[model samples]
Target chain A: MDEFIRIEHLNQRFDLSEPWLARMIYRRPKKFLDAVDDVSFGIERGKTYALVGESGSGKSTIARMAVGLLTPTGGRVLIDGQDLHDGSLSVAEQRRIRQRLQMVFQSPYASLNPRWRVGSILAEPLRVFRLVDGPQAEQARVHELLEQVGLSASDARRFPHEFSGGQRQRISIARALASKPDFIVCDEPTSALDVSVQAQVLNLLKQLQRDLGLTYLFITHDLAVVRVMAHRIGVLKSGKLVEEQATEKLIESPQSDYTRMLIRSAPRIHRAAS
Target chain B: MNGEKSAWQRFLASDFFYDFKRSPVTIVSFVIVVTLILMAILADLVAPTNPFDPGSLNLMNGFTPPMEPNAFTGETFLLGTDDQGRDLLSAIIYGLRVSLFVGLTAVILAMFIGVSLGLLAGYRGGWVDAVIMRIADIQVTFPSILIAVLIFGVARGLLPPDLRDELAITVLIVAIGLSEWVPFARTVRGTTMVEKEKEYVQAARLIGLGSSQIMVRHILPNVLSPVLVIATITLALAIIAEATLSFLGVGAPPTEPSLGTLIRIGQDFLFSGEWWILLFPAVTLLALALSVNLLGDWLRDTLNPRLK
Candidate 1:
């Protein structure tokens, strides 16, 4: 299968102790920690792949490494069937890759700088990547994005703090959209919002995904959100991937004990039967 | 994506400039500091007499009392004349000019050293950070003036006695600037340490930004607000340190009378009951320092997010 995003035997290890202290205390030359222990996964074009795990399961690490945020200790990540990152690339190549992939951070409000007005924040990627023609033309698109995200164009004048939590996440989503990226790594985009807002944001993500033909590597500990957004789910445990299957199969018939426990523990809300 | 229109408009409309106007003290001090800087920048056109011009001196006009008429010159001196027969008003303009020059040069030099070292230490974080921080700590133990003095003495000592006088001001500026740089470096290092962990920095790294670009573009802008506050306050401190050094006869030459040097020159006649000689320059220094320090305080309050 032609994967949109592919991770191959990726491993990340951090030096837990300083080199000097480790050497001096017991001649333990290097004190290392395996943050992501040989994790691998793939997401096909226009697909959503979710990594569901408890905290410290190395889910975030794997997600971060896949995007080339953290350098892997070993292995490779191929975005669009090209190893854009093995260690490092030329500046021009990196910029090209960044244009294709964007991120939505967990604390939606904190992710966008508070000092910046919403309109400018949204337009930043457009100007940085030179995606648009001029200021006047870019301003037109800014209004369009604000409208698309259910925000009035007048609201663009205000800062991030001025908006509600749900509105802020929408603004963040609009910002990610501004880059015209095909793949987005959403690191718990709705974790900081209320339950109502979470569903609203999740639904918006689904709509945008279908509309824009976007692929997502959605990272979250919340299994319910994973169920709603993910096409496939990979369960992680202690820096390792324990199971991988279709979202329906994983939810209905979880083989791994950790996955079963996670499914049991996830909060469910009552909905009218279709 | 259209950074220009957004940033400019926000800056114009923001409470930043309005906050400066809210306090009367800050307004007055800002005025004073701006006036002093203007005077220093435009010294020649406004000064009553050229203090540096040797042939213009009238020995008979020397020691004329403040606001009193000079007997031999028959000129009503506003602030009187110093023993060198230079008009006290003109001498002050000259003095203020020298003090400002030294202070500004030193601050710029210090900022250069501190900021570069700080960016390096913070971004590279190993033996470099340790060495820089330890050096800053060791320097901070002694008062900065002493460090300036020690550096000046060593630098001047290495030069021949004949070249020392000509090189004194440059040497003094270097000494004061190098000594004061530790605070800038320390503050920048602390800020760099915090900023390096931020996700945007990680994002930049992911996008394959070089370490230099990460430090310069991503981290520098975030760290600059604090550095600005520190720079403003340090400007006042740097000016004061320059004055103090000059007053001790180790600063500028006698031909170039900074406020501190003028005060030291006037001290001789203080006991002779020629009090105006000492009083006016002393008050000028007080006013200059107070105004600058006040402005620095206001800048610190205004720039800080916690206060806003």
Candidate 2:
């Protein structure tokens, strides 16, 4: 199947217990929230696999684990046959692996640092990975990245606040591409934008994927977005993956009640009688 | 060149500069503080006489009132002479120099220590955070002046008696710096805690950057605005702390008296009708402290987005 990304029974349990003193006084046991259950999925090379779930369904948790930002409490995340959470890997190996993947967060405003110019923001991955040698090369690469995201090269001199929400998402996508990563985890990248802007950003992502032959684990709560973006879809409910199938088949006939309900609840545009 | 010019023009047209121009009290305080600082920095060139020089003192000129000829020397003193016959104007100028030096060095020292510790505590946030914050909590319970006094006393006790006077100013700086770092640490820690959770920091982490790299490169810049505001406010506190210590007879030595020392010397003759000694130095101290504090207040309100 040439799976480019694999999640093997991933689980994440967050400690929600009170402090030790409070627990002792109240005679309470330690409490925990299983944010991500033993869920598993895989995406083939150059394909998009979308995880659709409402808030608190642990979609973001799975996304973070996939990008190695958060280590799962149980099981493993393998990228290109390498265990991302494996402690035995050397520091250089870990970094080499990290350079192959990147993330696009939900909130465009919160994702890019406000204090930094767009040039520095895009150049960070390039600099970190030592992709370019000197300042001139770095600047050239930054300009190239800015242009690749449909922004002017001069826009690199501006700050993130100067851009619209969709443009900021483009910058975020540009940053993700800076490392020349083959795999990207996009966690609700367009959910915060307006409908028109969302379509633009989604089209940009699809265009980037087509051009770069990239693999993506696209996370979102929007079935409409998934229909346009994903080849395969996984419906997540309360930290568990309830259904997984080809996107068209699932949209046509969602097996799980939760998936059916989610599809039904999604807002639709009504047409006036001609 | 064009970019630099536009950036300057942008800054001049920013809401910050507009706010600064709008407030009369802030403008007045800003002017006062700048003038005082300039006077202190240029004291050597600005003062009428070398007040600290023993050879420059004339005992016959003692108790000379403002703009009045001395009874014996027949030489008019501008702000008058002290009990030691030193020029009050010159003494205040030199005292301003010492006061400003001590205040500035102490605040820099405190900010460095506090920001570093705060960054560590907030970023690491486990046993490291607990220990650093607990120490900050304990230090904050006591008035900072008392803590400074205690640190000064302990430091003085540890030094050799012969070097006590020689190292007194340095020791005083360290004392005030140690005592004043609690506010900076608490403030930086609070800001760092909030900043480290931001998605940029998470992105930095995901990009194979180490924890320290994320804290320093990514998180530090974001957390610096509050730190700057705290530093400005802490500078005022540090200056006042230095003055209080000097006033208590343990700060700047007699050889090089600060404003607080001048006030201490001035207060002795206050009841004996020589009130100018006490009043002049006290007024200078009040002006310096009040202006700096007002500027700090203005800065806190301006830089804080929540206030806006």
Candidate 3:
């Protein structure tokens, strides 16, 4: 199995300290929060690798680092065997690596720019990557993207505010897919949507992945979502990757107490006798 | 075609338009501002006489009362003539043109400088943010008028004696622009800080767009609503500041008299028997400033979601 994306010994430390003057007056030492503590993971090509953790467990930090949005204090991310944060890489090389990956942010409300129309939003990545030629071609590509995301071509004329949360999330997915990326970092993509809407979005994501042969770095706190979406799961505890295994194997017989607790705590539906 | 029509209809039905229709003060002020701007732009064609031309001034027509024939020339002045014998209505019209021009150019200059600096500070934090914001903070400590006056004085002193009068308006615009930029920079910086944190901005960054591209393409649009509101309010302030400088005899020169210079000339005869000399131009300045201020206030309230 080829590793499509690899995060090696990643660490992120944020200085959470008061001003220098205040610290000196109070005689306090500088403080830091280790958000991601030397976590290492690799996702196989055409597979969903989910990172499960509660809030503040550094799930989003890893997600950000995976997508090259944040530079880690230590360690490096490699995409398709090429260093993503390599200072030696030229601008064109960096852009080439960046073009192969995209991010689907958690909040549909915040992810899509409010001022932009749906057409422009979808066209942005296409235009940036030079995926299409001419305005007519761009419009046609935008229309195709909208339809692929289960939206009408006419919907492209509307603003993000005019769409429902699920529809907006679909638009975000469409935008992520616009660049025709192989690897997508979905940082709790359905976490902000309705429970019913979440299932639909998850299904759409699964369908897209199957059709496109894409790899995913799925970040979420919900075990139920993990059970349904992840091929392999990495359970995180306070910035550390405690356990990682195949989703079913981990769910059936977890090695770590933390993984066991997580599985047990997840709500189950009782079957009714007919 | 149908979509475009509905979008237009939606705009007409938006809260902004609804608010505009509901408030009579906003309506009146909007009308006043539009009328004043149009009159200023069309001053050359609209005014009965070219007040700036020395050939057009008749010494015998000086101090002619409103709508009354002069005893010597039997010429009737609409608003009444100043001591210089320039037609008061025409002078007011031309004065308005100068004031509006200075005000507009000064605001544009301030907005350009302020928005750029603010975008830089907010998008690039740490030392870059610190340097820009510290300057803004220091500038904010002094009254804007004092800063304007200081800049105006230094600029005037540096210019050649012969060029002083010619460059006075340009210098005045720069001074007021420099003074007023603090507010715009401060506002934009605050907005940019918030906007830069948004996921959309992060998304733009993820696309390998340069920092400048993200700042200009993604973050700038998000931060512009407040900037526009600030720009509108600052226009009124810039106009008032220009007038204040001119009134102090440091602003627009006597040759090309702005409203402030007209008021200065009018004030000389104000204490004497010729009261209309002071009254008409003063009234015009008041109306222009007040209406712009009211329109700006309306815009601020309307555009700001917090206010709504």
> Which structure among the candidates has the greatest TM-score?
2
RMSD of 1: 4.4
- Could you give candidate 1's per-residue lDDT for residues A46-70 as a string of tens digits? 9899998888888888878777676
Model 2: per-residue Cα lDDT at residue A69:
88
TM-score of each: 0.85, 0.97, 0.96
Candidate 2: where is the Cα deviation over 4 Å? A269-274, B1-8
Clashes of 3: 0
Worst 10 residues of 3 chain A by lDDT: A265-274
Please tell me which model should have the higher lDDT, number 1 or number 3. Answer: 3
* Local distance difference test values of all predictions, in order: 0.83, 0.90, 0.90
Candidates 1 onward: DockQ, in order: 0.27, 0.80, 0.80
Q: What TM-score does candidate 3 reach? A: 0.96
Q: Spell out the clash pairs found in candidate 2.
A: none
i-RMSD of model 3 (Å, 1 decimal): 1.0
Q: Candidate 3: which stretches are off by over 4 Å?
A: A269-274, B1-11
